[model samples]
Target: MDIRPALESDLPELLALESQSFHSDRISRRSFRRWLRHHDRVFLLAVDQGQALGYALVTLRRGTRLARLYSLAVAPQSRGRGVAGALLKAVEQGARDAGALYLRLEVASDNQPAINLYRKLGYQQFGCYEDYYEDHGSALRMEKCIRPYAPGGDSRTLPWLAQTTAFTCGPAALMMAMAGLPGGYRPSPEDEIQLWREATTVFMTSGHGGCHPLGLALAAHRRGFASEAWINIEGPLFLEGVRDENKKRVMRIAHRQFVEQCAAARIPVRHADIDQGQLTERFQAGANILILISTYRLDNMKAPHWVVLSGFDESCLYVHDPDLGDTHPRQAADAQRSALDCQHLPIARDSFNAMSRFGSSRLRAVVIVEAGPGTAPTPAPAT
Candidate 1:
């Protein structure tokens, strides 16, 4: 099918397509006319043999980070071909040329095929709005950054730029570990009680490793949380003196020097100790905030790590895990008995406190800001 910019004459065909795709009673002709008059709206249509097959509608707003793709449709008969994809690509390129940082869209949650297609195109899932559409269906918000093209750089040869994808803490840690960061600090069950004592903030390292932690630390720093993570000698160190085991020993001897350096930069450092109970109590008292991190795993099992104890009941400790990947209050209870057990590692409320009390240096706390939904514009599809 030939793709072309939509003209006034295509309004009738566009309305007809919309009527066929949506409930005829819902999208009235009046609504279509109103849409046509909207300023800065980019509409496109695809046709073959004088028959309209698809269309896209986009809106370009000034002083925004991204262009919005508001609506896209492929005639029911033309669904399986690449009509929708081509329309999307064209709109993306157009947005990039117009100096947009990202292209954003919303898709119905039940439309798995569309979600998959968007994912394959480097779109990252960001958030969801409940009842965001006409039928009160949920909408999956997705975005793809349109990197400015450099004149001499070969797009084909360059590695894909790492887009700011979101993830929960646990899976994020695992990913970081797998990506060859310094992870795998599977603390001995016996080491748990000691670690909790020295820490003011518990940094749970889960998922891909330090990416979530780094991002969270940066965020916390912005929010006024004094954050620090002990660098294992064998792990990758993104920050100075934040390296593997050998460096840690040196850190212990030169503890004053390390503290001074961290103080000068407003970042604190202490060797890591894992504690389950004291950390939970601190969370309950509001002195400590847990940032649980995780990402989507293939099996759908809950990957919990680095949880903060926000509150507690008789059986469960209310905890916050950042692994939810969205800015919602992600709090869950840890069964008191189970939490006391040596599952992945050993942990106890008093044990962790005792360990911290005896450690040469205590755990460091960092400031972190929680991410939340902002007013993002609705995406329009290609005309």
Candidate 2:
């Protein structure tokens, strides 16, 4: 048997094996077609004598050195013949070649045969879900480090939490940053909404507006953290998307309020963009960063999103992005997101710089939080 990258011509046998291998939660023909063509996806098929034996699909997360084994299926007749193992090994190499340091997957908790195979192949269970499949079966989350561990100046470990709402990335990011600090601030789902309430500027097309750097700094200040803002734009931000005059007026009013509170709190405001070198210097000095980045490269949307910069290395910057929604186009309706793919994501220095700015005006914004009397020391570089 030989393993090879799947082609569109192999779709029929692939779908046939998919149908025979599982009863539910099967990948649709549309998804299969789309995933086959996606630049970030690796779909491999194993065949012998022109007969399909099995297949595996891996997705490379953009702006991160992480990949996910989204799906795997083997023909019933081909079981115990080592086809699955070959396909798995091939995909692991494929993911590594694509620059992914880690590969993660979800297996049914009761599927002992598959679990044993994964264990034999060196995947360890890191987490689990109570009822993940359509049949109410539990799932065991597993991960394998494809690349050798490099020590020093690596990412700092932080709690990985997904925002419950679409517009709550800022709140979720702030919560993660606060959790890593000295204070014992345990952020809950309730705090997510509360922080959004405190920092939101206006209304978004789908929900409330995104948070401003000044607003976030003020929120951090009120919570006893020393915060500072670095923004390139001078006045009322995120107003470019708002069309209603009344809403724009309200946003300006909210922006003015945040600016006033930041001034009264003595939070330093730098009306200029912060370069990567300066960001690295401040971070090494024990500051936590909540940065705004454009989701265009991440999710094909030009909207601003917030994430916590946990640490950096010579080539990549690690961040805890709060959003866990599907990044693939036309796949959200069928995809189930996992937190395993969102934590301590590694983005190349060049890619991070490109995505860190937002909009046609190229607005840049970031909030730096310094450890105060109650906060903890800066997190040690991750291993």
Q: Assess candidate 1 and give its lDDT.
A: 0.44
Count clashing pairs, candidate 1: 70
Off by over 4 Å in 2: 109-125, 135-137, 147-157, 204-207, 243-246, 281-286, 326-331, 381-383
* Cα lDDT tens digits for candidate 1, 74-158: 8899888898888888878777676555567778898898899899888888667687667788889787756642111111111
User: Candidate 1: lDDT of 292?
Assistant: 38
| Model 1 lDDT at residue 20 | 71
Report lDDT (Cα) of residue 369, candidate 2: 81
